[model samples]
Target: MCFRLSAEGTVLSVNRYGAEHLGYERNELVGQSLLRVVHEEDRPSVSRRLAECVVVPDTTTAWEFRKVRKDGSVLWVRERARAMTKPNGEAVLLVVCDDVTERKEVEQHLLEQRAQLRDLRLELSLAEQRERRRIGAGLHDSVGQDLAFARMKLRELEAETLASETRRCVEAIGQHLDEAIRATRTLTFELTSPILYELGLEAAIRNLVDRMGAQDTIRFTVRSSGSDETLPEDLNVILYRACAELLLNVRKHARCSEVEVAIECTEEGIRISVQDDGAGFDAGGAGKGSDRTGGYGLFSIREELQPLGGRFEVDSEPGRGTRAVIVAPRERTAIADAR
Candidate 1:
């Protein structure tokens, strides 16, 4: 629809469609200030642009603003206007307008949907962490305690001067119970480490490496350097889990005897890298082929970090060692409350 406005922004004339769209007759709108329809918040900008158009006659300018109808409803409109002078030396504006309200609404809806999805993803990640903590607590407090009691009972029986064969059986039972208790404790730690919440990411990573190093199978070394500041609890959990998963992959698949984990804080963010002297697989085929480490562990780490605007990368080749890096931003909204 097209309309003509005086240099002063009064509506000189409007086409049939333009007048109808504003819920006014062409005659009813004549001589009315254009600001009558332009949304109040946009009037100042529209006024300034119109003034500019007058100063630079014949120059075309484009803008989008909300226009209110006679019925009091508002609609978004895109306007392209050019300034011109009449034979009588009076300046005027010729404007072409298109209603863009529907398009604007659709764009807003899509933005809202994306935001909702992000919130949902963060919430689910936090919920999973909370469940892990609960399961870990249960294992340590219930099953672990029961196994400890059983070991104590066996030791008590051993002190009762039982027969040699019976004593031998009791001792064996006590040993098995001890192993069970140890296994339960290990499983509990795997479910969730208290150090993660107690001390922070660095200490948690160190504890994890130390516990695994105790097995005497894989030689694990951890090096860290940074401001001793703690990270947000949620990010701390993510980094710790990523490191744990990468190290586990090394222990299980890497035939190499040595693994190194390094963490450092830089101006950009935190950098964590896990490298191992183990048989490495094709990095390109990771998460695609039948590689064990390329399965859920790596995929999950990538998925979890994405919402936080963090990044995960792996570099490896056949017969060479694999190095996995995770970089997390220093500032992010905390998902810890979701737990």
Candidate 2:
């Protein structure tokens, strides 16, 4: 609906649609102050805008404000207006308004839904982390302890003088038991690193790289700087997990024989980069989850860092190797509270 108003905000004329929209007759609104229909709380701003429009008659301005209807109900309206001079040389405004109450309500509902989803994701992620810690503890305390005890008993049996054939069998059994114990420890560490909780991110990562290097499948090197500063526990976990996932991807998919893991603290935050000399896939395809070797590890890493206000990036080309970078903030209290 369109209307004209005097420079002072008196309604010069309003179309029938405009009058009916406000639940008033055109004649009744014609001489009324435009502020009479604007919601009281918005009147000051509307007044200032109108004064500005008069002074800058060539420019158009738009705003959204609440308007009071004849029965005292309020609804949102979007106004587009520009100043003009009447034939009589008096300044006026040609204003167009549209009822936008429904649109605003929809937008608000969408925002609320997005917030709910974010909260749900955070709760689920935290719960998953707790479950992993529980399983890791069980493996270390229960299964690992049992294996160690059995190995000790085998050693005791070996200490006794026995027939040559039986002694040989006992030695074999002891070796197998030792392997089982090592396997259990590796599994336990993979599930969760206690060092992450007790020491910090740097120690946990160092331990991870050390373990990987011990396997002799791939040569791993770690170069770190400025890692002594304390970080939020959750942020530390996220960065550590991101690094772990990327390294695992390198070991599994990158055909390279060597990998480099670098950790550095900067003025902004901490950065962890994992680089592999392995046969790399197309970075674009990896990001899109289209590369057969890419799997979902990189995507998972990205999702993990997003909530901490961190960033994840991958650079690679076929045969050029891949580099995964994870960055986390120095101060994460506000980010943690947002969760």
Candidate 3:
């Protein structure tokens, strides 16, 4: 849930989840000091963290802390807090947190037991690609070889036998086998794109943009700016998927013929935007299940965007096209450097 507080820690805004969890009505939470809800153990650390953020007001941090519920139950929470300023130049804070007590506990336990969670993450990535290659090898080595052998035997049968119907059936079976092998090859590449594993994010994206542009019905263009420096593979995947989602949303909800995808990188952060020339609608008209519909595609995009020092904004009108922009810290990539 989201909470926007004034400099004095008075709640100026409480999201629907915040209002329900704080055991306060919508109006009651406003103007209430959020410090009252801080669990005693975390009060010192939480306050310290906040101080560290405000002192510089440039660096951002994501943290996990405990907070006392009004019902007297303490929940382990993870906070995505950012330090900002109000119009009057007062320091204001906006926070989004989740009751991840159970999840945090699980992560903590795993951390303690596995001493190699970071290593495992690295291996998990490599292993995921290795497994894809293995599947590809299976298709090429076993299935592909079988198809070749079958075709050879069928050609021999065609030469030796005189039954026309039988020869045609044999050829068809051979064709099916060849088609199956081709499909398997395609599946392997899609599962773990070789370009990403072999080259890097920039080249892979360039290739992806080229492929997208080559499509017949819809036209696509991509603009890359900012730091094109190498980044963690996981960041590449997240950014790639986020862009892919936007384009897909365009294909589904937008009836436009062309779209533009742009990426900008700076010392502090990176921004990605996907804009379309299709019909748009009132974002406020979205309902709970709108996410399942085309309306909430941007919402899902935000879910992926926010975790890594990222944020997203959607702009659209009834007739004007939709533009989704994602902002993220350049250093805050999902995949850390290998130890």
Candidate with top TM-score is: 2
Model 2, CA-based lDDT: 0.83
The list of candidate 2 runs beyond 4 A from truth reads 1-101, 214-219, 254-259, 266-268, 275-299, 314-323, 333-339
User: What are the Cα lDDT values of the candidates?
Assistant: 0.85, 0.83, 0.70
Quote the positional error of residue 206 for candidate 1 in Å. 2.1
Give the residue spans of candidate 3 off by over 4 A.
Answer: 1-170, 209-216, 226-229, 285-289, 292-296, 333-339
Clashes of each: 0, 1, 0
Deviation in Å, model 3, residue 148 alpha carbon: 7.4
Better of 1 and 2 by lDDT: 1
Alpha carbon lDDT of residue 216, candidate 2? Answer: 62
Ranking by lDDT: 1, 2, 3
- For each candidate in turn, the TM-score is 0.60, 0.66, 0.51
| Ten contiguous residues minimizing lDDT sum, candidate 2 | 287-296
- Write model 1 residue lDDT over 15-68, tens digit each, in one string: 999999999999888999989999999999999988999999988999999999
Q: Rank the candidates by TM-score, best first.
A: 2, 1, 3
